[model samples]
Structure formats: C-alpha cells, structure tokens
Target: MVTIKDIAARLEVSASTVGRALADDPRISAAMKQKVQEVANDMGYVVNRAARMMRGVSSNLVGLVVPDIRNSFYSTIAHALSKCLESADLQLTLSETDDDRLVELRHIRELTSVNVAGIIIVPTARPHPESVRLLKMTSCIQLLRRHASLGEHWFGIDDTQALFQATRHLVELGHQRIAYIGGTTDLPTGAARLQGFHGAVAGSKAAAHVREELGAPASTDFGRDAIRRLLALRSPPTAVVLGSVQNTQGALEELHASGVSVPETLSVVGFGDELGFRWWGPGLTTISLPVSELATACGLWFIHQLKQKSANPAPYSSVSPPTLVVRGSTRAVEAANASRAPARSRQLAG
Candidate 1:
C-alpha cells in the first residue's frame, strides 16, 4: 500500500506537491506533474478512492444498466461501451434489470448512491419515478430504449426505418401477405418498429395482407410462440419480419422445429445481424445495426458531458441508420421472379 508520502519521499517533494500532481491540479507545473506521475506509477501508489468518495468526489467508474446480456444486441453494446471507456482509464460497472421496473429502480439507486462518474442505461418500458429522478441528478445517457419520463439525452437507431425497410423488401419481392413478430408498444423501440412495419405494408402500391403477433417483454419464448400462432393461420404469410433480436432468435428456433423450410416455405427477415444469423438456414436476411458504433459514440459523448461538468443545455439525441443486408434466406416469389430485379442484391454468405 504505497502512499502519497512514499512517492513524495522518493521524488524529494512534499506530500502536498505529490497529491496535487497526482490530481492533475493546474497549480503544479507540467514537468513536475510528469515526474510525479512517472514515479507514482512505478511505485504503484494507488489513489485513496474511499477518501475521495467521502469528500464527495466520484469514483473512476462508470455504470451501465441494461436488460439481459444474452441478447446479442445488448451484449454487443456492452462490449463496445467497455472498450470505449478503457481508453479513458476508466472502468465500467454493468447491471441488468431484466426489464422489471423494481429491478431497474434498485440498480439506479445503488449506482447513484455510489457517486459514479455517469450512468448509461437502456431504460425499461416504464421506469419507476424515483429511478427517473435519480438519473436526472447525474450525468446519464439512455441507449436504444427511451421513456417519456426521461429527457432526450440518448443514442439510438431509427427503429421505424429499420422495420419499414425489412417489411417493404418482402413486399417488393411479390409477397403480399406478411407476418410481423415484435415487442409491445410500451417501449420506444417497439412502438417505432411496429409503426415502420405497418407503414411499409399500408403505404405499398400493391394490396398487402398482414398479420402481426406483438406483446410484452420481447423474449425468445414470445418470439417462438408468435411464429407458432402465425403458422397456424389459415392463409400463412409468405414472408415474416422479426422486429426484435430476442424475438428473432425465438422465431428462428420455432421455424426450425416446425420443419418449415426458409425461403422455400417462408422467407424471414431478422432484427440484428448476430453472428449466428449468417449460419442459419440459407443465411438469414436481416437488418444490420451498427451496435458497436452507436455504443462507442454514446460513450464518447458521455465522456464529453462529464468533462463539461453537465449535460448540454439542450438535450442531445443521436440516431444511427440501420442497413438492410440481403442474403439467400430471402428470394423472389414466382410472380416476382421475372417481374423485376430483387429489392436488394448485396448478398453475404455464411
């Protein structure tokens, strides 16, 4: 347990000078700061974080609160965020809420109590009022999901456009009847995605037949159950658009178990470009979201806010666009086979 005094004695300087240099206090000369820092590093003079915390200073740790990490979507973001923070010599503290409001509240409360530098959260559909209040008191940024109770300090992708492009692609392939599987409208992502799917179907020039199975807590089980319901329909859709990542996984699982041949029986469009998606049957055509880019950008912005000592006067929001990737899991219907070129031609093989 090397202390400031040990570093000061080794450097032939007073403890106060060593402390100021370690804290990067402007009063210390750059050369002296450099010398002190080098010596402190070599001596392993760890900072007294507890003492600083007792003095009301934040720890060099940022907090991240998200839903299940099993979802590639959230896990990807977490990895990106962790890597981004590492460059700043900061550590990330991750917590999961399981989409439960009480669980969400508890995590936020614990994070705030610790005086973390900042917190990044994928807000639940309905956050507890106190959770909202605690976040407002800190430098907080929302990712992917948003609640009205929380301000506009967020980073996310265009959910509506993501779904619209997916749903419309099938329509252009001469598939009139389409089925949509997604989460409920309680969350912004769900609402926007559902809206996009509906928009693409209704706005199409051709008459479109649509069936949707949407409900709460978008999980793999829910996605699988929704596909089962759609498959039971008297006139099953020719194409299916999975609106959430968890739902996409579940839908694919059910589709496989039912012995339904993809593209041949039912063309499928998945939510995220998970690694396994390419290896799935005939390669799954899907929406490609820049999760890493979004997460990194959000982290950098939060770091900027921390430097400014407050959020930008006007709430800031950044929305990234999603790309629709084409693959063999989708093909032109017989009617559209010779009618026109496919909606997209950029093909990726597993």
Candidate 2:
C-alpha cells in the first residue's frame, strides 16, 4: 500500500518529484531518479497502473481470453503467447470464459475498463454483439475460433482442412466404414469440420460409408457416448476419425475400457497431437497443428502493432496448415479379413 507520499516522506522530497522520478521524466536528475527509485523499491511502493492509465499512459498489460484451459491446446498457446509478449516487455492477463457469451462479455468489459494494451481471445463460437462492439473499438486479436462479427483480426488453423486430411488418410488406408465424432454444427468450427469430412467422403473413389455423431458443446462424455453408439451399430466403423481433443480422449478411453485393440481391431485417428497421445495404447495417428507457432506469430504481430501505436491496425488473418502424423493407431484394410467387420464392442450404443 506504499504510495508517492510515503516515498516522498522517506526522501524528504515533494510528491510531484517522486512521481516524475518514478516515471523517469527528463525533468528529474539521474541522481534524484535513482534516489527516489531506490527508496520506492525499499518501501515496497508499486506503480498504480490504473492511475497512470487515467493520465493517458498506455498499459503494458495485455489480455488473453480462452474458453477452456484443461485442454493442453489452450495452455500451449498461453505459454507461447506469454513468452513472446514477455520478450516485448508486455505482460499477459488471462481469463477463462467457459465458452459462455455472458462471461465473455463481462471479461471484455473489465479488460477495456482498465484500458489494457490489447486483447487476444479464442472467442466463443458466437460472440456477444456487445463484446464484438467493444472489441471493434480496441486493439483486439481473435485466436483459434473467430466470430464473423469480429472481422479478420484472427489467426487459426483450417478446421475443415484438418478434418478433411484426417478422413482422407483413413480412406487412403482402404477403410470403407469410417465414423466421425465431433461438435455440433451450431459451432462454426464444427460445421466446417463436418463439411471437410463429408467433402472427403464425397470425393473419394472408394465406397466410403460415413457415420457422423455430433453433439453440442462436445466434451469427453459426449465423445464416449458417441463412440459407444457408433460401436453398437449393426455395421460399426472399421476406423474412427476424432474431430476434437475431447472426442479423441473419450473415444480412446472407451476403446481401452472395451478391450478393443487399436489398428488390429479398430483403427483410430485423433485430432490434436497432444504429448500423451503418442503413448496412448498404440501411438495415435493424429492431425498435428502448429498451435505454438501460430500463437507466437500472432503475439509478435500484436506487439509490432502495439509498438507502432496503430489505433486501427489493418485487418490481417493467417491460416496454418495441419499435418497428418501417421502412427501405430491406424492400419491398411488389406491386412484384415475381407468381411471388414469392426472388432469393437457391439453391445453398447451412443
């Protein structure tokens, strides 16, 4: 709680002198600035950033809003962003929105209230109109997921392309029956991913049998349920292409619990090359996204704009291509019996 008055009292100097010294103003001599700084540090005096902002000083703190941090995807991006921002002497303040529009709106209001240098958010599928209005008025970058209302200040991977690549990989492996488990079409990302899966199937020369299971606000539980339903079907998929991290986790868990052997019995393709995915049962064949690189690129661009003091930075967006990492989780259908019967449990239904 130490303030300018406390430092002033200790140095026996005026409060204005203390303030100017702390700010490293040219009016203050080097000796006086050092003296005031040393005293301020010794007395535990912290800079009141809000007060400085009221006087029109820009904050060095930036805001990062995400839907969920439990998933390593968000955490990885946070780490990359913090490192780049720190290199620029900017600090990151993170807020979790739980993918809720109301929570997103509140967080936006608070960040703008303090006049943060800028905001980088992995916005919800549908952002609040008010939140969009406020973001349009500030230096904001949308990450991963973008709402059309937020314009093109965005950086993300192609969701549709990722799924298309995954599905096509399965198709190329000679798997005729494939199931896709992911989010509902209510989310733009979900819609795009579904479109990609369908596109791959439609374009395939082979007779691809498609089984899609989409749930609103997809989670591990939904993933498990979807996989269970697909497996209980009369014609279970020979291979499964997971559409999200949660779906991958859930499907993998169900496969393990049901004692279904990966590739040997049921082939699996997962989204998000999470570190642990490499060790899950058989190593997971997955879509590898350059999440860290994307984060670093966005962070650097935002820092550049901040330094340039561009009140209205041009609308810029970039898409990173996802790579399909072939691992032990998938196999060619040629090795299996001609029946193409999936070996997973047929008793449980989604």
Candidate 3:
C-alpha cells in the first residue's frame, strides 16, 4: 500500500519529482534519483500497475507457455528463460497447456488479455486454427514443437538431424532391427523426428531391418507401452530410441522391469539430456538439445521484439542443432550373436 506520495513526503520532494526519479528520467539529477529510489525502496513503495495498464502501458511480465512443466525438458527451458528475463528486468508468467488445444488457446487469450509484454509458447501437437487466431492477438515467439501455422517467430532444436544421427549410430553398431518410441506425427518436431528415424534406417548399410513401432504423445505411459510392445515382438529390435525425456524415463523403467540390460541385450538412446541419464545404472547414450541456448535466444529475441528496439526485420527463426553424446548404454552388436538371438524368445533380456 506504500505510495509515491509517502516516499515523496519522506524525502521532502514533490510527488511528480518522486515519480520521475523512480522512472529514472534524465531530467532528474543522479543524486536525486538515487535518494528517491533509496527512500522508495526503504518505504516498500510499489508501482501502480493497474494505472499504468490503463494508460496503455503493459507490465514487465512475459508469458511462457509450455505443454508440461513437470517434464524436465520444459523445466530446464523455463529455468534458462527465467534467468535471461531476470537479467533484462522482466518477470516470467508461466502457463501450462498440457498439449491440449483448448487449453493452449485459452492460455494465449488470457495472457493477451493481461497485456503480457510477449508470449513464448511450445504449442500443442495439433493446434487448431482458433489457437493461431488467439496467438495473433499478442506478440508471440514459438518455442520447441511449433505447429506449421504458427512458426513465424520460432526457436527450436533440429529434431530431425538429431534423430537421424541417433538412428544412424545404432545402425552402425551392426543392429538391423531398431525401434523408435515417442512423439506423435501431429507436431512438426514429432513428424521430423519420425522422418529422421525412417530416413536413417532406409539409408543404412544394414541389409534388412524391422521398425517395431513409432509411439505417440511423447509421454511416459506411451513410452512404457511402446517399449513393452516392441519387446514382445517376435523379432524384437536390437536397439530403441526415445524421442523425449519423459519417454526416455518411462522406457528406462520398462527396460529395468523386463530385465533388459542396455547395450548388452538391447541398446538404448534417448532424446534430451536429463540429469539422471548421465548417472543412471548405465549412462544413457542420447541426443542432447541445447535447452539453455535455445531459451536464451528466444528470451532475447522476445525482449527485443517487445521493446521494438531491434533493427532487424520481423519473422525471425532460430534453430539449435542437437548433439549426440555417446556413453555406456550402447555397444556394437556382434553379427553372430544377433543372428543366433533372433528366435531365442527370452523377451530381449540382457
């Protein structure tokens, strides 16, 4: 409830002088601004955000909309974005869409209604046209997993190249049967990753390989179910690649439950470098997305756009390529062992 008048009276200055000093107006001398700010801080003065909004000024709050905040991938992005926005003197207003189209549209509209400085969204898999319409109501920067219709200001990782390299790595280990689990073909990232998996398998020097399954939604349940089904297959895959962090975690759990030893029984690769992956029983060999760099780039870009201070033209797109980190979870398959194990129906246990 502290007001500028209270600070002004305490500092023996006029309210207008206090306001200008609080805003750091050039007309206010440095010594005066310092004194006003110190007194205002000590008095716990708070800005009249509603009054500023009424005068056509927005709060220094940016909206970050993501599918699931509990997912480590999105959580890491949020952390990085928070740090970047903090340095720029802006606060993050986070919203979760849960990958639901209606929720996504609602979040965007709500943020716009509040006049958020800008919104950064990792949109749902199949965003409706209404969602796009709602997004146009505010300045928005699309994050990972952008829909084709709303990629005007997008920043994401190269999902296709990442998966392609991962699949190729498994192929190079002399395994002919590989399975990809995670992501529906609805979103661009999902479709691109699936294409990358197929592309690698098709181009590999392996004579013939079987693709067990391509799961959907990139959730823990989907990952767990997909791995179970693939393992139950008669000629099961020798390697499995997960498309998301949640999927990787779920798949790892399934593997452990089924007593499948990574690299020995079935090689495993995952998307996104979760902290647990590095220290798990067998370190995961996986594709690592540049979460921090992507968040920083998106935060800076959105901040620039919100302030209209950048000289660059609009319709910006930034892509961070993924990197594959090799670890203990993958190993070269011996040709003799692969041939001998095709019919040994112990259910892919290492």
The numbered model that scores best in lDDT is: 2
Give the per-residue lDDT of model 3 (tens digit) for 1-350.
99998998898889999999977789999999999988988888888877877787767888999988999878888999999999878999889988888988888877877677778889887787977876676677888877668747889888889989998998888878888886778778888888888888885654366564556567888888889898888987888888888888889888877767666678899888888888765788999888988999888877777667554437888889899999988888784356444423334322
Comparing 2 and 3 on lDDT, the stronger one? 2
Count the clashes in each prediction.
Answer: 0, 2, 0
* Candidate 1 residue 47 C-alpha distance from true site, Å: 1.0
Runs in model 1 with CA error above 4 Å? 203-208, 335-350
Model 3, global lDDT: 0.81
Summarize candidate 2's per-residue lDDT along 154-203 as a digit string, tens digits. Answer: 99999999999999988888888888999988777888899989888886
Q: Sort every candidate by lDDT, greatest first.
A: 2, 1, 3
Q: Which ranges in model 2 have alpha carbons more than 4 Å from their true place?
A: 5-18, 24-36, 205-208, 338-350
Lowest summed lDDT across 10 adjacent residues in model 2 is found at: 341-350
RMSD values, in order shown: 4.2, 3.3, 3.0
Q: Give candidate 3 regions above 4 Å deviation.
A: 128-130, 205-208, 307-313, 335-350
Q: What is the Cα root-mean-square deviation between model 1 and the actual structure?
A: 4.2
Q: What's the lDDT for residue 309 in model 2?
A: 82
- Which candidate ranks first by TM-score, i.e. highest? 1
